[model samples]
Target: MSTVACPDCEARVSLDTPVLNEIVECAECRSELEVLSTDPVVLGRAPEVEEDWGE
Candidate 1:
């Protein structure tokens, strides 16, 4: 997941890769956020996981 800040509305937005090339409006302040760069975005979350995905 990735988090981006809206300069227009100063909203903290969170999204995944699919939302990468998308222009979404900030729900908080209704500002347009254009994902300018295709570079993968990363949030400052923990870099580790505990559970396995093979269920």
Candidate 2:
């Protein structure tokens, strides 16, 4: 497991065998975060969900 900072709440989060581009939720702020890197444990805000009308 690795520790990463939350972009929204700046809280420490533990990632268990995280992968690149994996989506995770911040425990403190409950914000959706995306895994940008795994070496140093980088996290970013997840992209906004877009509505699909049977496209």
Number of the top TM-score candidate: 2
Error of 1 at 22 (Å): 1.4
Give the distance in Å from residue 8's predicted Cα in candidate 1 to where it truly belongs.
0.7
By lDDT, the best candidate is 2
Give the alpha carbon lDDT tens digit for every residue of 1-55 in model 1: 6777766655687776634446666678766566666465422222233688787
What is residue 19's positional error in candidate 1, in angstroms? 5.1
Off by over 4 Å in 1: 18-20, 40-55
lDDT, model 2? 0.92
Deviation from native of the Cα of residue 40 in model 2, angstroms: 1.5
lDDT of 1 at 35: 68
Tens-place lDDT per residue, model 2, 1-55, is: 9998899989998999989999999888899999998888899999999999889
Model 2 RMSD, rounded to 1 decimal: 1.1
User: Candidate 2 clashing pairs?
Assistant: none
Model 1, residue pairs in steric clash: none
